[model samples]
Target: MLLPMSIQAKSYGWGFKKNTNHQPPDVGVYKNILDDLGGYYLDNSGDKVVYLTFDNGYEEGYTGKVLDVLKEKKVPATFFVTGHYVEDQEQLVKRMVNEGHIVGNHSYHHPDFTKLSKAKMKEELESLEEAVAKITDQKEMQYVRPPRGTFNKQSIQWANELGYTHVFWSLAFVDWNTDSQKGWKKAYQQVMDQIHPGAVILLHTVSKDNAEALAYMIDDLRKQGYSFRSLDDLVMKDILPEPIIGF
Candidate 1:
């Protein structure tokens, strides 16, 4: 039988023994590895907005279809990709860039930033920064989401010093497990049920269930008066338009 969630976290390196509150990563200060990484913090005050993001650790087997849905919907998004996956899925990454989506680094080995040594973390991030540069002209890949939402004050300081804005999820669904029976159904319900204004929904692109549910999820959210937006559209100060809907 499966162990409890808390126990599972221990086995999977998701516990808070590595964090101040046993919470997901948050920003503070990090060692400097680069000078252009961007970071984000809570900015939307009294507004109902949501930012959708995905971590491409490997592949969800449905990323292509997910991209197609986003492309068809003409909605922009941020795709956090790892170096190994980027190398393996070069064509898809190219398509993402060519199709006008934002691709950020998800580290090379998907290590928990807090668990890695400062130097190792720097290398992990820098390696991908270089690899992305090799594929695209966007030299300033400033955004990073630590693997498994693990971060700490020191790691955040280090990442910030390197110019990266560590992103964490406001909402996430269990779309990573292929063995789950109700993966897509549970994902759909979880996303729709908990969605709030300015939430950042985290989806894994390595799940076929997530892929199958992507378009429907977008449509459902749209029907509920939410519009899909890219992380860039939501955060970047100068690029965003005046607020259309807010609470």
Candidate 2:
């Protein structure tokens, strides 16, 4: 089913933004750092593959539709859900797990990790992990995305101590405007121009435009010789090579 064109686009409305000297997180906060956050694209010998991930802070009225498209496409994705979204949309959380999508921690309240005290930061990460464990019966939730794409040395170090590989993204569309839908052609072009193997893409389920255009984008990427997979797969084996374009 196609999402109505009349359905307005929506932003994540995380209630915060971060402006730092660091390069915007393409995999996680450490993507701009020398050491890097996690190894997403370490080996580039295979066909171009894209990693699709979503940040779930709250409901924006389009997530369910996005899930439907993903389900139909038989594509797996990773969802970084905040504690709030997880609790608020527990049923959807169950669906994600049941449908074989990876659900990682996006923090309890979606705070900027670098600004929070070390203890508080750790609490944020662990609390969300615990919440998911309670519902999914899974004890491990190792992937993370810092709220607002903000992080620092201490934040990354603390997360590592907690055993999380901070995940950011390399490609994104302007889907955060609640007033106007990000045009499908623009969204498709933005991604196609930057298509790379092991690239992590951040598209919010909040945007109806994203949901509507998703299937088409998937088909186009497949034709371009790129396969779609979840981030969980990238962490499990050495299937992707490190990106040569933006690192």
Per-candidate clashes come to: 21, 12
Q: Could you give candidate 1's per-residue lDDT for residues 1-247 as a string of tens digits?
A: 3334452233122221122231333322321221233445323433445566888877646889989988887767788999888899988888888887788878998877766767898899999988877887666677788887665555666777777777666566566776773756766766767666556677788777777777777877777676666666655543556654321
lDDT of 2 by residue, 1-247 (tens): 2223232121122211322222222333233442443433222344477778888888888888878988998888888999889889988888888888889888999887766776898899889988888888566787888888765555666678778887766666577676788576766666666666656778887777777778888988888677776665666555445543210
Q: Residue 226 CA error for candidate 1 (Å)?
A: 1.3
What TM-score does each of the candidates earn? 0.77, 0.79
Error of 2 at 21 (Å): 24
User: In model 1, which runs have C-alpha deviations exceeding 4 angstroms?
Assistant: 1-43, 181-183, 237-247
Model 1: residue 240 alpha-carbon error in angstroms: 7.7
* Candidate achieving the largest lDDT: 2
